[model samples]
Target: MANMDISLKEMMAIDGAIGAAVVDYNSGMSLGVLGGSKDLDLQIAGAGNTEVVKAKLRTMDSLGLKDAIEDILITLSGQYHIIRPITGRGGKGLFLYLALDRGRANLAMARHHLRAIEDKLEI
Candidate 1:
C-alpha cells in the first residue's frame, strides 16, 4: 500500500495535474499535499473542497438518494477538479482532491488512476 506522501506524489504524475491533497473533511485539514501554482493554494483548496463534499452529501440525504458518491468532478474552462472520498475497508471521513489542466488531462483515465490509488492507500 502507498503511504500518504507517496500517494500524493503519484497523483501529481497524472497528466496535467496542478495540485493534489489528502484531506480530512471532518476537521478540514490536509494530511498531505503536492504542487500548486502562484495563484493556487492547495491548503485553501482542500478546505474549500470539504464544503463542496459536505454540501453534496447533505443534498443527497435531503433528497433521500440511496446512491453513494464515487467522486465529484467540477469542470472549468481550463481546469478540472476532482474530489474522491476514500472508502477503504474501514476508512472514514477522508478524501483525495485533485486539480488538473483540462486541456492535458484525460478525465476517464485520471478517474481510473485515482480509484487505483484510493484502493491501495493506507490511511
Candidate 2:
C-alpha cells in the first residue's frame, strides 16, 4: 500500500498532471498537495472541489440513487479536473483531486492511472 506522500508523488508523475491533493471533503481541507503551477492554488482548488463532491452526493441522495460515485470529471477549455472519492476502509470522507492540462493530458490514461493510485492508497 502507498503512503500519502508517495501516492501524491505518483500522481504528479502522470503526464500533464498540474496538481494533486488528498482532501477531506467533510472539512474542505487538503491533507496533502503537490505539483501546482502558479495559476493553480491547490488549497483553494481542494476546497472548491469539496463542494462539487457534496453537491453531487446531495443530489444523489435526493434522487434516491443507491449507487456510489466512482469519480467526477469536470472538463474545461484548457484543463480537466478529476475528483475521485476514496473508498478504502476508513476512506469514506476523503477524496483524491487531480488537475491536468487539457492540451497535454490523455484523459483515458489519466483516469486509469488515478484508479491505480486509488487502489494502492493506504489511507
Candidate 3:
C-alpha cells in the first residue's frame, strides 16, 4: 500500500499534472502537497475547495439524496481541476486535489489514474 508521499508522487506523474494535494475538508488543511508553483498555491486551493465540498454536501442533504460524491471537476480556460474525496475508512474527511493542464491532460485517464492511486493509498 502507498502512503501520502507515494500517492502525491504518483499523481504528479500524470501527463498534465501541475499540482496535487491531500486535503482535509473538515479542517480546510492540506496534509500533504506537491508540485505547486507561486502561481498555483496548493495550500490556498485546498482551503478554498473545502468550502466547495461542504456546499455540495449541503446541497445533497437538502435534496434528500443519500449519495456520495465521486468527484468534482472544474474546467477552466487553461486548466482542469479535479477534487476527489477519499472514501476509505481511514481516509474519511480527506480528499485528493489535482490540477492539470487542459491542453495536455486526458481527463478520462487522469480520473482513472487517481482512482487507482486512491485504491492503493493507506492514508
Candidate 4:
C-alpha cells in the first residue's frame, strides 16, 4: 500500500497540479506535502481547509443530512483547489488537498484519479 508521502507525490503528478498535502483536519496539520511554490504555503492552506471541512460538516449536521462529502471544489480564475477527505481504512480525520492550474486541469478526471489514489493510501 502507498504511504502518505507516496500519495502526495502521486497527486503532484496529476496534470496541472501545483501543490498537494495530506492534512489532519482535527489538528489543522499536514502529515505530508508536495510542490508548493513561493505563493502557496501548504501549511497555512491546510489549516484553512480544515476549517472549510468542519464548516461544511457542521452545516450538514444541522440540516439533518446523512450524507458524506465527496469533495469540495473551489474554482478560481487561475486555479482549482480540491479538498477531498480521506475515508479509507485508518484514514480518519485526514484529507487530501490538491491545487491545480485551471487552464491545464480536467476537473472530472482529476477527481477520479484522486479517488483511486486515496483508496490505495495506507496511513
Candidate 5:
C-alpha cells in the first residue's frame, strides 16, 4: 500500500504533472502538498476544490443520483485539474488532487495513473 508521501510522489511522476496534494474535503485543508509552480498555490487550490466537490455532491443528492463520484475533471486552457475523493478502505473524507500541464499531459494516461495511485493509497 502506498503511504501519503509515496502516493504524492507517484502522482508527480506522471507525465505533465505540475502538482499534487492530499486534502481533507471536510475541512478544506491540504494535509500534504508537493511540486506546485510559482504561479500556483497548492493550499488555496485544495481549499477551493473542496467547494467544487461539495457542490457536485450536493447537486447529486438533490437530483437523486445514487452513484458515487469516481473523479471530477476541470479542464482549462492551459491545465487539467483532477479531484478524486477517497472512500472505502477506511478513507472517508479525504481526496487526492492533481494538476497537470495541458500541453504535456495525456489526459487518459494521467487519469489512469491517478486511479492507480488512488487504489494503492493507504490511509
Candidate 6:
C-alpha cells in the first residue's frame, strides 16, 4: 500500500488538481497536505471540510439512511471540491480532500483517481 506521502503525490498528478489533503475529521486537522496555494490554504480547508463531513453525517443519521457516503462534491463557479471519507481500518475518522480547477478537471476521472488513491493509501 502507498504511504501518505506517496498518496498525496499521486493525488497531485490528477488533472487540474489544485490541492489535496488527508485530514482527521475527528480533530479537524490535516495529517498530510500538498499542492495548495496562497489562494487555497489546505490547512484551513481541511478544518472547514471536517464540519461539512460531520454535518452530512448528521443529516444522514437524522434521515435514518443506513447507507455510507462515498463522497461529497461541492461545486463552485471556478472549482470543484471533493471530500471522501476514508473507510480503511488505519484511516478511520479521516478523509481525503481534493480541490480542482473546474474548467480543467474531468469530474468523473478525478473521482475515479481519488478512489484508486484511497484504496492504496496506507494512512
Best by lDDT: 3
Note the residue pairs that clash in candidate 2: none
What ranges in model 1 sit over 4 Å off?
none
Q: In candidate 4, what are the lDDT values of residues 1-123, reduced to their tens digit?
A: 899889999999999999999999999999989998998899999999999999999999999999999999999999999999988899999999999999999999999999999999999
Model 5 spans > 4 angstroms off: none
How do the predictions measure up, each by TM-score? 0.96, 0.98, 0.98, 0.98, 0.98, 0.98
For residues 1-123, could you state the per-residue lDDT of candidate 1 as single tens digits? 988899999999999999999999988999899998887799999999999999999999999999988999999999999999999964589999999999999999999999999999998
Ranking by lDDT: 3, 6, 2, 4, 5, 1
Residue by residue across 32-94, what tens digits does model 5's lDDT show?
A: 999998898999999999999999999999999999999999999999999999875967888
Give, for candidate 1, the lowest lDDT window spanning 10 residues: 85-94
lDDT per residue (tens digit) for residues 65-104 in model 6: 9999999999999999999999887989999999999999
lDDT of each: 0.93, 0.96, 0.97, 0.95, 0.94, 0.96
On the 0 to 100 scale, the lDDT of residue 8 in model 6 is 96
lDDT of 2 by residue, 75-107 (tens): 999999999999997788999999999999999
Residues 26-76, candidate 3, lDDT per residue (tens digit)?
Answer: 999999999998889999999999999999999999999899999999999
In candidate 3, the residue pairs with backbone N, CA or C atoms under 3 Å apart (3 or more residues apart, or in different chains) clash, namely none
Residue 3, model 3: Cα distance from true site in angstroms: 0.3
TM for candidate 5 is 0.98
Candidate 4 residues lying further than 4 Å off, grouped into runs, are none
Question: Where's the lowest-lDDT run of ten residues in candidate 4?
Answer: 1-10
Worst 10 residues of 6 by lDDT: 84-93
When summed lDDT is taken over every stretch of 10 residues in candidate 5, the lowest stretch is 86-95
In order of listing, the candidates' clash counts read 0, 0, 0, 0, 0, 0
* Runs with alpha carbons beyond 4 Å of true place in candidate 2: none
Whichever of 3 and 4 has more TM-score, that candidate is: 3
Write the number of the candidate with greater TM-score, choosing between 1 and 3.
3
